[model samples]
Target: MNLMETIHLHKNDFSKTERKVYDYIVQNPTAIETATITKIAELCQVSTSGILRFCQVLGYKGYKDFRFDMLHYLHQEHVEVNSENLFDELTSKYLSVIRQFNNIDQNKLNQLIKQIKNTKNIYVIGVHYSSLPAKHLVLGLQDLGINTYFAYDYMQASHLYNTIHEDDLLIYFSIEGNQNNVSRFFDLTNASKNTYMITLNPKPKLLIENTLILPGYTLSKQSIVDLQSIVVIFVELLLNMFHNTLKED
Candidate 1:
């Protein structure tokens, strides 16, 4: 279940103080995107500790982690509409997503970026709808003069896989992270030390070695619109970082 569904499923299990916090969260999710624990407590008429406990009840490490999840959730929900006058709402949600991006561990992202940059060639694989981001990533990297290829067809993907070596990089994108094609791509890339995988599947068991796990958001039951927005933003930021590092060097 996604974060929103999980919260709703266990709503009745919350204590009175927790219920107040929960209600506040449900009502002002966007506000919570940038809200402090003190602010949340004040808004909910509870103590800061009570807010922490509320987050712990939801399986987060603490209030900060809970806020991150909430921000992701709010962004996922608000970014899909085609409203004209909703620019303010969209801007707020966009800023919230960027804030989450900013909070990503710099050391980890720098390591991933270095891995990508140092590789002789990069192959990005994604199947079905997940292929959207893979293609975007390749184009973004290419614009920065990186050697990148995006494989969408099975035959081309297979050919690309056969050519991959230790000096090359493989970046896989899978929303569910369980598709047969995605698994096969991982198996092929597993022999190469430079392989990395990104997916929305949050299950720990689904993670593979050498993967840089990024959280994915689901906007609708039938579409991965939110995940697409996330992938675009992430790839753009990564490309900018890569370019900036090159200039610095």
Candidate 2:
């Protein structure tokens, strides 16, 4: 259920401080995305604990979880097509994603690639829309003669753990990084040696063991089309870098 429904169902049960948080969120749903817990508390004249309690009452983990859910909710609600030069806007947005990728930490990329090169088994998994990119990446790795596998479903993906070893790697692809199923899967297979994630979420909901995070688009301007292209490009560069390192050695 969405936060609105949850709030409505439990509105009467809210404490005085929680009431303030509920009222503020109802009045300014858009503002909550970027607002810190402290800012929200100050605005409502309540403590941080109040905000936490409010989120908990609404069935969220904490303020951060509430923020992530609210951000996605607001985005879905506010999807608008700008009639002013559609082509130009799309082009600009796509370029912006690439520019964001260019600024990624080279050291982190190098380290991640090094892990990929040495890993005997590479398992790629993504949920919903993220699967498109995950498929592309797995195919590219296979072309390079890597033993890559893409998980089509949670059950099929879980089978990998039976043969999982210390030199194996799991690359998780997520757009928002808030899938409950994905988190559960990660927990069930926590014994994996290296867990890497490529995600647009700045703050992931789940933290897997030995996880290497590669952060992607910060803004939500790009559509799925743009996102797929950006992801493919990122993986292409990773493959090139891996090849270059091998050639140099």
Candidate 3:
């Protein structure tokens, strides 16, 4: 989470004295990014130690870590997910999906952007309904100046998976999370910490920490119906943040 999100999430956890500091920071987000702890303490009418305690209450070791995340919050684009005046079930469902993606831990989104920025090579794989979303992500990465490899064929997936190094990043865009076939399962057999999966389900039998879940309706792993259009929107959302980060740089 970014500094603002962390404070908002834990606002009530702060002591009464700390709330003064909270109110100041909330009212002056941009100013807080540039202010030192002592200056913030003066502005909030609290002692320097009180400001230190306030940062610690928000899980920061000190003011420097807090300022760094606050600067990130200042530089990034603010997202507004609009889903008003909708009556249809499909629209309602899609709005819910978008809100879920919007509410994903922002720190992870920031870290995912960093992972893309730092990785030397990225191999993205998908199949069935997920092929287009995978390609969409690959193209987005390529647009951001990352050397990304795209794979939809089983042989290509296998080749990428086998040749993937510890430094290389592997991305999977799967609607069902788990594989629908033995060949695909074989291709994903070596998913590591460097692998990231964006999917509707987390039952992929891989490292859960790297899995980014989304909301969608599905009947089976190989169901005929595809809800991957929402996946495209999700990819676009991510690409927007990545593109914004690029502009910030």
Tell me the whole-model lDDT of each prediction, alpha carbons only: 0.69, 0.69, 0.71
Q: Write the per-residue lDDT of candidate 2 for residues 95-160, one digit (tens) a residue.
A: 544544534556667777888888888888876677887888788789879898788666666675
> Tens digits of per-residue lDDT for model 1 on 200-248?
5444344556655443332222243536766666777788888888898
Best by TM-score: 1
Off by over 4 Å in 1: 1-98, 103-105, 184-192, 204-206, 215-226
Scored against the true structure, residue 98 in model 1 reaches a CA lDDT of: 51
Model 3 whole-model lDDT (C-alpha atoms): 0.71
Off by more than 4 A, model 2: 1-84, 184-193, 209-226
Off by over 4 Å in 3: 1-87, 180-190, 205-208, 218-224
Model 3 vs. true fold: TM: 0.58
Q: After superposition, how far is residue 143 of candidate 3 from its true place, in Å?
A: 2.5
Between prediction 1 and prediction 2, the one with superior TM-score is 1
Q: Candidate 3 clashing pairs?
A: none
